[model samples]
Each structure stands twice: as C-alpha cells, then as structure tokens.
Target: MSVPHAKLPAWAEYGLIPLVNLAVAFLISGLVVLIVGESPLEAAYHMINGAFGRGEYIGFTLYYTTTFIFTGLAVAVAFHCGLFNIGGEGQAYIGGIGVALACLSFDRVLPWYLLFPIAVIGAAFFGALWAMIPGWLQAKRGSHIVITTIMFNFIAASLMNYLLNRVFKPLGSMSLETRTFETGGQLPKLDWLMSIFGLSVGNAPFNISFLLALLAAFGVWVLIWRTKLGYEMRTMGHSPAAARYAGIKEAKIIVITMMISGALAGMMALNPIMGEQFRMQLDFVQGAGFVGIAVALIGRSHPAGIIPAALLFGMLYQGGAEISFEMPSISRDMIVIIQGLVILFAGALEHMFRPAITRIIFGLSPKGRQAAATKGA
Candidate 1:
C-alpha cells in the first residue's frame, strides 16, 4: 500500500510528535521513580537541581549532553538514510585509537593550538573509515546493515583490546593500556570562557566540547532540512525506489551517509579525550552507541529534537549517580530502570497514549506562535 502523504507544517509534524514523545518519556521516568519508593515529584526536583540548579551541576550535565549528542546524531543520521548503522560502538572504539594516536604523535611535535583540531579530525576520519566497509557491503551485497554492523562491533571491541595490549600499550602499564596525554596534547583549560564569567572552573568538564555539540546539532538540522543531500537521504529512507526514480543514487548516498554517521560517532572521543580528562580510555563511554538508539527514538530522529532528549538522559544519569551516593539503599542500576522505561514509552507513545496525545504543543503554544509570527512579520 502506498503511504498516505500528510504534510503538516514542519513544526507541526516534527515538532508535535517529539513533544508528545517527550511527555511520555518523562511520565515513564516519573512512574519508575515512584516504583523505587521515592516520591516522583521530589526525585524530579532533585534531578533538576543536580543537573542545573548549581553552576557546577549545569557544567556536568552539559558534559554528558555533549557526547550523547554526538552518538545520538550518529544514530539519527543513519536512521534517516534508511540504514541502521549500529556500529557506533565500534566506530567510537576505533576513534579512541585515532585520538590517542593523534595525541601521542603531536604531543612533542605540535603546539596545543594545532594539536586539538588535528586530534578531532583524525578521530572523525578513523571513525568514518571503520563504518565505510559495512556500508559498502550493505550497498553492494545487499547485506543487512544491522547484522553486519553488529559483527563489526565485536571486531571493534577485539581491535581495541589488541591495540591497548600491543600497539598503544605504555611501556610499564599492563592494566588495559590507558595512557595520559602529554601536557601539550591535553585539552586546555577554558580559561578564556571562564575569564568572561569570572567563575573559574564553574564546571571542570564543561569545556569547548559543549559548544561544538550545539554547533554540530545545528549543523545536522541544516544538513537534513536545507541541503539537497539530506533531502535525498530522507527520500531514500521513505522509499528507496522513489529516491532512485528521482535520480538519487541509493548505493552511493547510503555509503556516504553511513560514513558521516560513523564520523559523528567518532566525535564521541572529544567528550572524554578533550574535556577535563583529556585522554580516551575503554570505559570513557558506557554503552553509548546502544543508548544512542534510545536518544534518536526519543528525539524522533530530528536534530533539534535531540537537545532535550539528551538533556533528559543526562539528568537521569546524573541523578542516578547522586541518588546512589546519597541513599546508599538505591544503586545506580535503578537509573537504568528509569531509562529503560523512558525508552519503552518514547518508542511506543502512540500505542500508550493513542489519539489525544496528538495535539500537544510543547514550547510553542498558540500564543507563542502568534508572538513568533508577529515578530517575524
């Protein structure tokens, strides 16, 4: 059956579905909190306070937001391209190697100014390279990307173990091969940013990576909406035959999109290697590639939609940590329970809420719409 075409204003279509999903995600989170024998209301308030009420807290939350955006954008892009590029874990693993090598190579040879960009570009390229082979296989051999990428994930994990054990192993350490970046290779303090606010180290990890994530999100928005390439991707996603009929090369675009997707995943290195930590280690990220799927679902596969979704994940994750520390009775795994429920609701919101969940406006109410229109006019 041909899909019925329903074109709402971009705001109504993309904006509405995600807003509905967000409400559902939060509701699920709340119920989980209640089930944990905690007051949902108080837990939520504490979560918000831990995330943003204090200056340091905001920085930390942004720290989580930065990398989640990278991995989530990776997943979102592949979803739009009609490909489930599930190899984000592997790509990120490979990227860690790239960043580590770049940091090591440039440490004595280059200045901090040049080394940072070098490391970022190197990480992204390596990430893209890791993803390209599976993309090629899918396009050429009609392989299932999900299966291929999952296999590659094992390969990536194995490769990480090998490299840390052999190639990148610091001479003395046998414990999982984590080596610190040379001082020059380390990400510099955001003295310049903090200088402006007169709040030195307001948040240690809230560095330039946050700015880059926001820019990348905006860039993804423009790429998917304003660019011809993105339109082709969306078309391919909806109907590959129609896309081919429209003169789009499905194979080429698929491979390219996966490369971009993997590259975005590789950018995950920055969250750990370029923040206060300044080096990539195996556990620097935690199942980020997998969680990215949840992020994309919650974000409704739109770039702008990703922001709050990531922030929500960040808050729960941060709150989970604080809760574990303070309560002693609760463990961090409880947050995982909340996250699992949120994902369930976001994924099944339509079934859960049915029709009435249809007409909710999140940030843009009717009054806000009029204000926006009047201002634009």
Candidate 2:
C-alpha cells in the first residue's frame, strides 16, 4: 500500500554533503567578492597569499593562532567528557584579572625571572576557579552550566568595569589604565628569540607562550588519547549510566575535566596579555569563547586537529583586517560569513559521511543485508 523510502546513500554518510555545503559557501564568498567590486579569484588569491605567503602575515596568523589554540582546546576538552563549557569567556576574564593583579603587585618586587611564571600560574588558577564554580553548580546543585556561565560572563564584564572605573585606576591620571612598568616586568621579546632562528619582525609579540601553546596541544592530545582517564572520560561522555556500570566515577571525572577545561581557557589569555600586549585591558578575551565552539566543531573535538582549524580561523582574522584596509567600504563581516559557512559544513560533514562510516564500522547496511539475502537465492 505504501512505498518504502530508500536509505541514504553511503557516500552521503561519508561527508559528500559537506562538499556540497562548501560549494555553496564558495559561491557565496564569490558573490560577496563580486559585490565588493573585486574579482573572486583575485580577492581569494590575495587573501590566501597574505595569510600564508608573507612573513609578516605569517607572524600575525601565528599570534592569533596561539590564542585560539587554547580556546579551541578548552572547548574540545569539555566536549570530550560530554560536558558543555560555555564559560570560557568568563574564565578567561577571571584569568585576565588575576594576571593583571599579579602584574601590578609583583612587577616591582620580583625580578623578571620569578614574575612571569608567577603571573601565568596565577592567571590559570583564577580561571580554573571561575570555571569550576559553574562546574560545581552543575555537578552538585544541578544548575545548567550553559546558563550560569553566560551570566558569569556578564558578571565578569561588570567586575572589570568596576576595576577599570574606581578600584584600580591610578589617581590623577584620568585614565583607567595602570601605569605600564618600565623595567623588569616586560615579557622578553620573542623577536630576539626569533632572531636566533633567523626571523626578523617588529611590533609583534612572539613569546615563549607560542611554544607553550604547542606543548599544551600535545599535552591535551596525550591526556585525551593515551590515558585511562581519557578512556573513562570518553565512556562517561557517551553514556553516564553506562560509564557508571563500567566503574567510571562520573562526579570526579566531571569536576576534573571541568577544571582542566577552565585552565585551558585561562591559558588563552597569555597569548594576548603576557605575549604581545604585556598589559591588561578590559574585554580582551574578545568572543574567543564563542569562536572556540566553531573551532572545536571543525576540529571534530580532536586536539591535534585543532591546530589546522585554529590556523584557518587565524588566517580569516588576518585576512579580514587586510581586506578592511584594501576595501574600506567592505565590512569585516565577510570573515563572519566564511566562518559560519565552514562551521555549517564541518558540522554536517558527519551526517554526510554517516552511512559509509556506519557501514564500515558495522560491516553492513540495510541494502547490504537484502542483497546478501538475494545472493543466497
């Protein structure tokens, strides 16, 4: 009486749909380029060349790349344990405040040797506390962390406003900014380090934090893939009840994962404050938490995959600035458009590839079963 629906093609499950999504994005980017009165190929070519071709652009790209690595990894870590940590912004703000406070306190007392590490650790600890508060609420009180973290972001912003406005402002300066310490506290120029490697660049903040980021990425990879803790975390992520039956302690794992995620979020601040700017400003996290979701999605929640995804984001960021310069009329919104498209495609890629993936994993499809039945005849 009724026709049966055909199963989705195995190719569709393998991410063929994502390719279609990408084609759609390219057409849209092309349209945008044309609307801006530039050749699509030319604009795209220049964008690619600028982002990856030039040494200066390369430096800028890496600068952002370093920050995004932490944010993306932060998001990915929580995702690994089936926890959603949307509080990365708040955690980063708290870390920023800690680093700011530390810089103001010990900048004069301690030599640069001790000051830098202390500030970084202080920042990370503060971030962990901020993140853990929400995590605790979720674990202990059944509070929705997503909602709480969003609220915390606002609270942290208000707290920053208070600090900038009254508490930390230098008297008679008529500015919220603290006095930049002239000696001993400044981050050692990575450019000098770069000179040892034959890289010459100025006004950019390349620092030891760059190496720290790579090491952190590797560390996250090892933690997620190579440890029993990682196995328990994954099991809990897939099914908390199942994990419980398998002897995985959900609460302990949840708290630990949340703390680690928060710390990773805190590490994001180092790239901006300690690495380049060397001074604190309010609102420095700059939506990195939200951007991190896209980064994680594109990375498929893999730490190693985060590198390329972060690089893609960093390139778009640099390209947006350059495009803004070349075509003042064109809004930086193009970057937003492209990023949205990438997230959309990457998210759908699994669905696109799902059938083949499932069949490969399971060794048969519905059609495969039917064909085998016919072959037996």
Q: lDDT of all predictions, in order shown?
A: 0.76, 0.75
Best by lDDT, which number?
1
The sequence of per-residue lDDT tens digits that candidate 1 reaches over residues 279-315 is 6666555777777777888788887778877887777
lDDT of 2: 0.75
357 in model 1: Cα distance from truth in Å?
3.2
Quote model 2's TM-score.
Answer: 0.84
Clashing pairs in 2: 12-352, 13-352, 13-353, 13-354, 13-355, 14-352, 14-353, 15-352, 15-353
- TM-scores for the candidates: 0.86, 0.84
Candidate 1's C-alpha lDDT?
0.76
Taking the tens digit of each residue's C-alpha lDDT, what string does model 2 give over 217-310?
9998999889999888888888888999998877788878888888888878877776666677768888777777778877777876788778
User: Candidate 2 — which residues are off by over 4 angstroms?
Assistant: 1-27, 192-198, 348-377
| Candidate 1: stretches off by over 4 Å | 1-17, 191-203, 348-354, 358-377
lDDT of 2 at 279: 72
